[model samples]
Target: MAPGSSAFKEVVESHPKQMNHKTLKMKAESGTVKTSMSLAEKHSIHGVHELLQCPTCAGSMYPPIHQCPNGHTLCANCKIVHKCCPTCRFELGNIRCLALEKVAESMELPCRYQSLGCQDLFPYYDKAKHEKHCPFRPYTCPYASSECCVTGDIPFLVAHLKEDHSVDMHDGCTFNHRYVKSNPHEVENATWMLTVFNCFGRQFCLHFEAFLLGTAPAYMAFVRFMGEDSDARKFNYTLEVGAFGRKLMWQGVPRSIRDSHRKVRDSQDGLIIPRNLALYFSAGSGQELKLRVTGRIWKV
Candidate 1:
């Protein structure tokens, strides 16, 4: 081999690993290391989302992310319960993963309820807040009976209530019904009836229940719009019950079923009748209950 070529070859062979490492060190120190960390990259969003997921809970990591001595990180909620790194079993420390937190601040993500028909993108910081109030969030079954665990979007829940729960469905804004019971005095904290009424291309739930209003046994009747609260505000309803020339009426806005039936009932924002008054309106002996309820719903 030529003299110069042979000398160069010997130098390269003597410390090849060290020379390559020194070059990499220089690139890193100068902030010129070629990396796929740019946000402009096509896969960067997905990669960042994956990176921010807590190893322990698989949830997106928020602020105060804690790290173990070996650089493994977990979310704040998991940190409180975990004594070691979930990823590497390394002993955890009080160190916060500030780098990861800063990275999250620079990102944007689609709503977690995108599959539920929410077509909105939010910055990482505002994502949780938007998701909390997202209209497309799944709704629990509105069946007055507390036995149903079903939850889904409006159409799915509507079908579920009809087919699975066998709930009555009506097609009018005005309704009149007679509720009869064998024992008017045997009042308990239980749901009595739930009727679905479709009007103005929307659905409403008329809920009736017997519960203790403070210390007195009372019966409550109310209506709930099966849509978002904002849309529910566009409508109002009136309920009236009468007998023996005496009548009781309540007029108010229909609450959104987004508020659970129990929640609305407990709020007592509906027409409530005391057990004694209800029996007085009955057609027969005080032991039997036969009360008539008439209501109308209108767009406001």
Candidate 2:
């Protein structure tokens, strides 16, 4: 499509298939995108549904997206694997479904985080990306893998840890606690215990585990916030591990969610102690490791 005076002008030139859509793009370009709820008063939802589905993947197709020259539609990802439409086999040029998109622009879409109790209504085109890292998305208990695959929001997870797991909760950002991996000989990459701390009106997860970072029996402890990564930037946390003055400190903006706790340990985003240092801390008294980990979180 050629670049037009305004964003919607380009839409007008590219997507004028129906009478209503002839200048709809131009109007929308001039800041007149309507809501599906508003349009529902006049247009039928069925009209929007008929063209919203991608024939190849059956997923919802957003507008200004791709379609075949014959007008058979597919989501952008599905169209990547082939140059021709699956149904009509028409050469997949850069033809766009302008009218379909115009309708889509008006639709009130639900958040993908709806299952987690997020009720935000976004435009059809913005919902998927918005919900991926939405703060209200369902979260697993940060403690460990549990038979209780029960999901909850941040507050629910906080209560679950406090009551069910008996996790210790501290206020403010600074913490001076001793995290003990009593069974370092267990040799399984398992979490010993997880604690929670609150600071900057936000909650952070403190994960303590006995794992093998690189074949040496090691202990790792890290912190993660209970929100999206964007929210994580509101505060930064620092964890220091030391006993004999040889301290290892890590300061980073916590992740909203722990994609992989192991990945954080592997990347050494926290205070990681190998057998040598761990043994020094233990001082051959036993097969356990006691790390005096102190941390503080502050607003940015």
- Give the TM-scores of the predictions, in the order they appear: 0.82, 0.64
In candidate 2, which residue ranges exceed 4 Å CA deviation?
1-43, 54-58, 62-123, 133-136, 146-149, 181-183
Model 1, residue 277: displacement in angstroms? 0.6
The residue-by-residue lDDT of candidate 2 on 2-104, one tens digit each, is 1110111000011111223111000111121343345564365556665688878878886557878777778888878888889898788888777778888
lDDT of 1 by residue, 1-300 (tens): 111111111000011111121110001111112222445653878988898888888987889878888888899999999888888888888999999999988776766777776555567777887777777778889886567778898889889988886667777778886676766666676636777787777788887767888888898899998878778888899988888889999999999888988899899889998888888887577877777788988878
* Candidate lDDT values, in order: 0.75, 0.64
Q: Output the TM-score of candidate 1.
A: 0.82
Whole-model lDDT for model 1 versus the true structure? 0.75
Q: Worst 10-residue stretch by lDDT in candidate 2?
A: 4-13
